[model samples]
Target: MVLMQAEKTAIGSICFLAGPFTLLENALVLGVIAATATLRRRPTYLFIASIALADVFASCFFTTSFLDFHLFRQSDGPTAYLFKLGGVTMAFTSSVGSLLLTALDRYLCIHQASSYKVLLTRRRALLCLLILWSVTIFISFLPLMGWRCPTGLIPPCSRLFPYVNHGYLACWTSFTLVLLTLILCAYALILLKAHRHETSMTSLQGAAGTGHARMRMDIRLARTFGLILLILVGCWLPALSFMLADVFVILTHTQQRAFAFCSTLCLVNSAVNPLLYALRCRELRVALLQLLQRLCVIGRCKKTTQDLPPGIHFTEEISCTAITEHEIPTNGTMQLHSVSEMVNN
Candidate 1:
């Protein structure tokens, strides 16, 4: 029993520490996107703003679960119910759903261009956002309303009763599998279309420098898109696979770890998008640098204002000090001069 408790404690601690990195990464992404927009003269990222909010809500579960188990010395005190109901269920689930929406948005933007704007307009995105949040909240609230039981347990705090394991994993698994299959098929078709266009260009131009250059550009773009697809698959597959396995075979302790790891990986994946964008897209990188500098300047100004002495009379003596240091003298003495004060040392 003691050993088991210790193991849980250790795992929980690791989880809490690792989870915050997701927040930091997301925050950086938000900064980068906003900075890029201002520097490049584009609009700010309303999408990133939503994502940042969701990630923060998700942390209520990610951070608290770990701290309750590993950080707090108290074995029991204000946990389980509050954290699971308010934190884990609401925050984490909404975050995951937001990710699904994000993936679908990107997929549509790349593959189904003709209807993209019409279907994925501001109104549509907002509607989708509302629906996703509503669903998550409703699902999480089912237990409290006595419609369904909870799912799991934290030591001496909250416990989740397995309600419908078959539907639990099967539903999400089937939904994801179907959606991903369609997404991949669409991407494949899009690639084929791009290739055909390139071929016609090549035929017309006889593979000149411009045609060759376009071909290379096409290949690089395809590679970048492919990377994003692979990341989505690699991060989510483990958890989905475990959910499937749980339906047929027993989910051993090892499998539990794998599922949990997958969940964590997906969370980290949300934070990774901006980094990948910056690395694969040059424009993104430049924008990111600008945002960082802007934020730094803003931060510096705020700090300076906060630190300013009281009543310096806004326009005191305005003297500019230009300090110059002469090269060390032959005798190993240093020379310093201030232009404004005309002082020598």
Candidate 2:
């Protein structure tokens, strides 16, 4: 009841905040994809793109629960709503699974550059995502296997457990710990490799082109993701431990609210990934901005090109060997250009 009331008063707050959060994330992503027009050309963005979309879905999912209870009176659905089965498990599996694969993609891109082409292809990304979702689905549904639902109940969330939810207890605990450990080791390897990379470059002449920049960006991404993994673990660990302790001894209502509160912290991870990648990876930012600019041009030119039939148009969104504004000397000018080819019959 307390949680429900708190959520009610918080609707305006969530809408004001989470809505814009979703928009910027969505625009930056669709702008990239639309401007690129071809996925193969921008393979570096594949993982982030996938995760951003998944984050959007995740935000929608969790918000539904809050909105349903807070905004709608029981008389509106009261008993006939489909909201219960809509959000929770699907959102969890996709969001969490997406993060895991995001790390795996980064590992492949950084560690195995030789076959990064062959290994992290689009099909491979889709297949990995499918596998992750399949596993998440299997585990998320485990609670349903033994539990029975009480009929005519709105939301069907209450009476979800005969006792404590042992299924949830086991799944979230093991999954968070294992993923957090693996993400740590993967990032540690990236840092070690980055150290070796920097040392091997003997001169300023050697540190040229996108190679050095790419390496630095990858290292930064690894560090950011490592922090994200830590945050994921940190956010969930308290709640997880508390829940497990409930099995040993009864938990007070205060303890349950504390556990519930912890889940909201995951939203921070969902919120910030866009800013991190945009700010950290120089080439990606260039590509993204170039894409946006190209889209604006296309928008302006759409009605003017009447002589041309329905023909395909291509503008380059890929910009390699970029020196970001921060890196350039105060007196030096940063030269940035995109190589574009317009295709017409």
Candidate 3:
């Protein structure tokens, strides 16, 4: 009892401090993605946005629960655990499931390059996201709906900690393993095709222009997705393994402490996702840079309107003036120039 309580406090403290920061990061990523028209239009980023949204909610739920406990010294009651469990499961599942859809989308793009757009239309993508959320919500609330918690206990509340049900654990583990395997297989085939195409490009005559561009894009995408997969596996594998073990093998106090560690480690995935997107994605990097520029413009009042870039503002209105000049010099040479500038206070 003493060790378990200690584990919760120690682990919970770390997560409590980290939660707000994670929330901010994911929120910024989502903001950037939403603000940029180019990113929001892409089918892949649609899934990325879904993942970011899930993480944001996860951070909110987790942070709120932790604040209740840390600030007010609240007990581990049913309500608190319900919020925590719902948030964690939904976030984790959505993040992983988003990756699965992304991998499958990339595979289709590679294999059916001509028909990819026709197949995965915006409507279809939206439908997929809707289904993903529906399934995730259902699975997350199963325990609350009478799967594990016994009947006739006080005013109806289940004990906190080790919410794992053996039947649910088996089903969850199987689903996750299968989905991850599919993601791996899809990426493997993508890498293989990229390698072959790159080799063939090397042998082609005068293929440097488009061929090199395509090869670079393919290789960069593969690497980005590969990094995402690695992060996902590293973050979640320990938690999944321990969850599986808890089904058959009874864990000692030490093992339970380790489970606490694993659980926190998994939450790290949500924290690091925005960082990964910012670093690995060129489009997102550009959007982040623009966002920062806008912030800087809003902060400093000394910069002249002429110095600022076009259309960078917070709540300020940008009024543009366009003037065209046509001049005839002594040499009878005619010149025309057009200038457009935004007038700002």
Candidate 4:
């Protein structure tokens, strides 16, 4: 029992440290997207912005409630506890829903390259976001609205066990599983289509000129989608499995510890997302660097543009020129310019 308590203490410390980092990471992504007009107009970055925003909320609420429940052990009444859990649930759910939207956007980009713009306009994307938040808010707050355990329940009533309804967990888990399945299927089709495109290009243009460019673009996109798919499964599957199990059977002490660890693993996803989804994109990266530079200037830092790092200075110049001249190539898609094309190689 002492050992178990020590382990929990270590995990709680780690969670406390990770919370602020995740919040800053997502907040930077959101700031970059909001400050960059070029990114805001595109559907992909808009979805990314939604994900970042959700993560910002997730990090804040999850860290607060999780620390309170595990470490502080303070007794905020059942109403306050339920509200915190609902906020955390709603934030994470919105993050997942935004991820699904991003996957669909990528699929449409590859599948309907020509008419993708018409299919998913900025207005439609905003509407979809609005609808997603509305549905998730309603679903997440059901516990607060009378789906919780009865008031007469014993001391364990504060934790998720007797506090939140089991039926709600089951339903939410099922819904999340369905979303994951759809995301997986979407990425699968995207990879298949990219493969066919590659094969066709190789057969038709063997050892040829512009075909190599197209091939490289397709390959890069495939790699990005593959990485996203891998991370999503790695981060979410274990937690969902544990949640499903908890819905049916009571967890032993060890099992509860494992579940808590798995839940923390889910929060790690939010921290890594800016690296995978936002910073990996050349345009967004350039914009983020520029945003940082502007912040440095406002802070009265003595660093000059020449003092910037090698590749960043060059890339920032190129990005600024491209934005100013409106010469960023899209290759008939609505997405931002690829890194290769952005560098004008």
Each candidate structure's TM-score, on Cα atoms with residue i matched to residue i, is: 0.65, 0.65, 0.74, 0.80
Tens digits of lDDT, candidate 2, 193-213: 766665566343465675667
The sequence of per-residue lDDT tens digits that candidate 1 reaches over residues 1-345 is 112556566656556665677667666655666555442232124444455656765655656654454345335322344335445556655655555565566666656678876766766677777887787777665544554334443222111223433544465467656656665665566677677767778888884686777779789868976986788678767766776777666555655644554656655655565455333446656666766666786787567546755533222221111112342342122211222223321
Query: Candidate 4: where are CA atoms >4 Å away?
Result: 1-3, 151-160, 208-223, 298-345
User: How much does each candidate deviate from the true structure in C-alpha RMSD?
Assistant: 8.3, 10.8, 7.6, 11.3
Question: How do the residues 61-157 of candidate 4 rate in per-residue lDDT, one tens digit apiece?
Answer: 9888887777776667768878998999999999999999998998999899999999999999999999999999999999889888775233323
Clashes in candidate 2: how many?
0
| Total clashing pairs for each candidate | 7, 0, 0, 0
Which segments of candidate 3 are over 4 A away from where they belong?
Answer: 1-13, 63-80, 151-164, 203-226, 295-345
Off by over 4 Å in 2: 4-16, 38-44, 70-86, 142-164, 197-230, 246-248, 298-345
- 2 against 4, candidate with superior TM-score: 4
lDDT (CA) for every model shown? 0.56, 0.56, 0.69, 0.80
RMSD after Cα superposition, model 1: 8.3
- The candidate 4 region of ten consecutive residues with least summed lDDT is 152-161
Candidate 1: count of backbone clashes, pairs at least 3 residues apart or interchain? 7
Better of 1 and 4 by lDDT: 4
Model 2: ten consecutive residues of lowest lDDT: 331-340
The alpha-carbon lDDT assigned to residue 76 of candidate 1 equals 39
For candidate 3, report its TM-score: 0.74
Please state the error at residue 83 of candidate 2 in Å: 6.8
Ranking of predictions according to TM-score: 4, 3, 2, 1
